[model samples]
Every structure is written in C-alpha cells, then in structure tokens.
Target chain A: QQQVKQSPQSLIVQKGGIPIINCAYENTAFDYFPWYQQFPGKGPALLIAIRPDVSEKKEGRFTISFNKSAKQFSLHIMDSQPGDSATYFCAATPAERGGADGLTFGKGTHLIIQP
Target chain B: DVKVTQSSRYLVKRTGEKVFLECVQDMDHENMFWYRQDPGLGLRLIYFSYDVKMKEKGDIPEGYSVSREKKERFSLILESASTNQTSMYLCASSRSRTGRGETQYFGPGTRLLVL
Candidate 1:
C-alpha cells in the first residue's frame, strides 16, 4: 500500500519540448510527494516537492501537478534541453500521520533530452 | 545549505569481508537515511535513524545493519558481504526547520562492489 508507481521506464524528448512523468501512489496516508533528479555518479537531489493540499507547484522550469483524489502526481519539465538528461525518481512519505517513515520510491524513469 | 558526505565514492570488497559505509551530515538534522540504488529499483531504503542511537529498519534491511554513534553520523555495515550486495549506496538527511517533508539533502553516493 506504500508503493509509489512511476511510469515510462525511460523518456526521450526533443529540444524545447515538454516532458511529462507520471506517478501514482496507493497509500492515502501519504501527503508529501517529492521528485528527485540524479546524475551519473551523484545521489538523488530534491528537484521539486508538493503536498496534497496544493494542486500544483511551480519552480522555474520544473513543475509538479498533483491530484489529491486521484492519488496521482506528475512532473513536467518545460523547455527541455540536452543537459536535462538524467534519472528521475518519485518518492512519497506519510510522516505527518505517523512520526517519520522512510520514503517509498518508484522504479525510476530515465529521461533523455535531445538537442 | 545542508551537506551530507559519504566516506568513499567507490569501494571493492571480497565476498566474506566485512564492509562499512560511513555517512556524516553537517546540518545536524534529526533524520538520517541509507538507501541502495539499482537500475530498475529506484532507491530501496535499508535503514534510518531519527535520533542518536535510535534506528528503524526499512523494507530492504535484511542484509544490512546500521549504527548511529553521533547525531550527525550514520554508518551502514554488512556483516558478511556478498556478491549481490554490489550497488550504489546513498546517504540522506533532512532538516526539520521548515517542517516534515520539507526537503532531504543527499550525499554524493558511494558505489560498492562486493566480489
């Protein structure tokens, strides 16, 4: 029930195109969802995050679209560039309900942006 | 800025050898986590510590153990390393200043190869 399922094991987008990545969670208790981007030899870093309270949150070229009832969320990268190629992971946690639980991550989606 | 540092960037050990992966955070956060990353299995939590000398096992903690001697440092240990243990390990810590699920700072990651 704590699993966060992410789709499109990989993605490829042309320059200046918008790339969308989708994720779904089963545990309703989870309210905090964060998307992380990881490079070849680095750990996953927080790119953008959103709580269930807000429908969407935007940060520069990265944005998070959330649907509380649907129990689904997605990350949209606007104006994709070749440098945007990396592995993206969606993770969720239900810490407010409980104390602090580890994040349950999905099977990451590797994204490649063509120049 | 929060800083999470790992002991090594790459490590190689024999099958029956004991291994230790050290992680330290300068942010003095209350939460510290250890995860392993595989090609398809995004990031699987191994163990986490919420306070000094307090720890909880996550989903995939069967072959791993952890120690939190100090609040800023967390260590992951493999009693008897096996070949299957080869993977990229990550260290993360989160600051509670903002609130729960605010953000997690990650280390540069350490790739371990057990042969």
Candidate 2:
C-alpha cells in the first residue's frame, strides 16, 4: 500500500498551455503530499505541496489539487513555459516529528513545452 | 537556506567493487535521506536517519546499507556494486516539524555508473 502510481509518463504542450500530471496512492496514512521538479543533471526540487485537509494549494503558477477520498493528487501548471519543462515527481509521507519517514515517490512525468 | 551537499557529482565503479556515497547538510536538520533515481522507476528510498547513530531501512534497502556517525552526515554504501545499481543518488535533509508541513531540501545529486 506504499505505492504512489502516476500517469501520463510524458506530456507535451505549447508555450502558453496548461499541463497536468496526476498521481494516486493507496496508503491512507499519508498526510503530506508534495511535488518535485527535476531538471537535467540536477536533483529534484520541491515545487508545491498540499495536505489532505486542504483540497487545493496554489504557489505562483503551480498548483496542487488533492482529493482525500479519492486518494489522489495532481499538479497543474498554468501558462507553462519552456523553462518549466522538467521531470515532475509526486511524493507522499506519513506525518512524523523530525520527519522520520522518508518520502515515497511516483515514477515521474516528463513534461515538455514547445515554443 | 538549507544546504545539502553530496560528495561527488559523477562517479564510475566497476562491478563487484565497493562504493560509498556521502551526504552532508549544513542546516543541522535532524532527518537525512538517501534515494536512487532511475529513468522509469522514479526515486526509491534506500535508507534514512532520524538522528545521529539511528538508521532505518527504506522501501528498497536490499543491497544497500547506511551510516550516520554524525548529525550532519549520512552515507550510502553499496557493498558490491553491480551494473543494475547505476543511477542518480540524491541526499535530502529536513527539520523535525511539530506540525504537518515539513519540506525536504535536496542536494545536487551524484550520478553513479557501475560497469
């Protein structure tokens, strides 16, 4: 039940389009959900995150929509630009003091925005 | 800003050789994590340390081991390197949180090639 399944392994869009990546988990214990963005030859960076208590979170042009009952979450990029092209990963962790548990990551989605 | 640093940006090792990947964080975060990222497999946790001298095995810890001799350092060891172990290694650190919103800071990552 630790698996976080992600879909649309790859996505292509125009410079001003919206690209969405989706992920689902079966573990009910997960309380924190985060999305990470990784560029070529770089480590993944935290993009945006959401908790099960909140249905949605917006950070700049990035947003996270979470569904508690559906056990799913999604990342939406509004007005995606070429600079936003990167491999995105969805991760989850059970809440712990001092962050004891390591994050469980999805397979990843490769996003490309054409000019 | 939290700074997580890895020992190397790229490494090459022969099969059957022993390898060590080191990570250090300057933020004095209590939690440290080691993960391996592959093309289609995403990021898989190898191990984590909640505190000095305390280590825990993650989801895919079969052929790996970890060391946390100090609060600032964490190491991932491959006793016998294999071709299948080639991947991008990431180290992350996070502060212990009283609430549910904890974010992890990642290093630049080390790319290992086992021949």
Candidate 3:
C-alpha cells in the first residue's frame, strides 16, 4: 500500500488566491508529516510540516492543517504567487525511528499559480 | 544551512553496466538516504544508512546496494543497470534528535539513463 496518497495531480490557481493540496496516509503509526516543494531541475525543499499532536501549523505563506483521527493533512498557500508554482509532495514517518532513516512519500501534486 | 551534494547530475550508461552514485553532506548528520524518482512513483527509497558502515534496504532495493564508509558520505551502487532503472536519484541527510521530528535536506538529483 502507498503509505501516503496525494490528491489533484495538478493544480491551477490565480495569483493572490489560495491553493490547497491534500494528502492522506494509511499508516497510523506515522507521527510526523512534512510537505516538500520541488522546482524543475532542482531538489525538493521542505516547505512545511506538522505533527499529529497539533491540528495546524503555519509558516509564512504556507500552512499545514493536520487531522489525526482522519489520518489526513493538507498544504495551503495563502495569496499564491507565480513563484509558488512547483511540485508539492507529502511525506510521513514514524517518530523515534531516527530521522532520515526512511520516509514514505506521496505522489507529488504539481501546483501552478497563474500570473 | 545543510548541503548535500551528489557527484553526478546527469549520467548515461549502457545496460548491464555497473554504476556508482556518490553523495556527500556538509552537515554532521548521522543518517543518509538514497531514493529513486519515477514519473508516477514520486520518490521511492532505495537505501539508507543510520551511521557509518551501517546500511539498510528500503522499499526498492532489489537492483541496488549501498555503502557508507564515512559519516558524511553515502554511495549507491547498481550491480547491472537496466532500462527500467533509468530515473532521477536523490540523496538526503538529516540530524537525529530525540523525540522531535526534523526535516531532511536533499541534494540536487542525479538523473541516469540506462540504454
């Protein structure tokens, strides 16, 4: 089973609009959730992350809303700009397994912000 | 800032040829990972090392092997490259802290084409 699954293979949003990408995970043991943004020809960068203990976490223009019972999380970009266009990925991992050991990743969602 | 560097950005190899990909990290992270990215598969872990001289198989490690001789370096080896193995390879490293989940820093991917 794909430990994590992302929705909307591609997303298009007008500038200044809010774009949301959702992800659901199968493994209940996962305690940490992170989102990565990847541009063409570059490595994916961590955008935002949330732990199951919290319902939401926000960093700058990006926010991660997590639902523990639902086993789902989402990334929401406020006032989306063209520069925000990139492939967004959601990933999960069980805590105490040692960070960087292994992470289950979701199929990326290509987010496009229109100018 | 964490910096993970891969030796090759793009490579072309003949089928059945032995291939080696090297990765180095600037941060003194105790963990390192190698993953392959396909069009639909997103990122699939191939191998990971928790400490020097310790390696573990990931989800897709059938055709791959890994070496971790130094704390900052991890290497992925393909015994016999095949066309199906052609994909983008990524390397990542992260610090291992207690209880808290941390984000991983990634290197620019190495794209390999096996013909």
| Model 1 stretches with alpha carbons more than 4 Å out | A97-99
lDDT of 3 at A3: 85
Report the lDDT tens digits of candidate 1 across residue range A75-95: 999999999999999999985
Query: Each model's TM-score?
Result: 0.96, 0.96, 0.98
**Residue B36 error for model 1, in Å?**
0.3
Per-residue lDDT value at B57 in model 2? 90
Give the lDDT of residue A115 in candidate 2: 94
Clashes of each: 0, 1, 0
| Candidate 3 whole-model C-alpha lDDT, 0 to 1 | 0.91
The C-alpha stretches of model 3 lying farther than 4 A from their native spots are B97-99
lDDT of the candidates, in the order given: 0.90, 0.91, 0.91
Residue pairs with colliding backbones in model 2 are A98-B96
**Candidate 2 on B22-114: residue-level lDDT in tens?**
999999888899999988899999999888999999989988999999999999999999999999999998888454657889999999999
Across A14-105, the per-residue lDDT of candidate 2 in tens digits comes to 99999999999988888889999999988889999888989999999999999999999999999999999999999999985536788999
Model 3 lDDT, residue A39, Cα = 97
- CAPRI-wise, candidate 3 is medium
Query: Which candidate number maximizes DockQ?
Result: 2
Model 1 C-alpha lDDT per residue in residues B1-115, reported as the tens digit of each score: 7889999999999998989999999987888889998888889999988888989999899889999999999999999999999999999987663366757788999999998
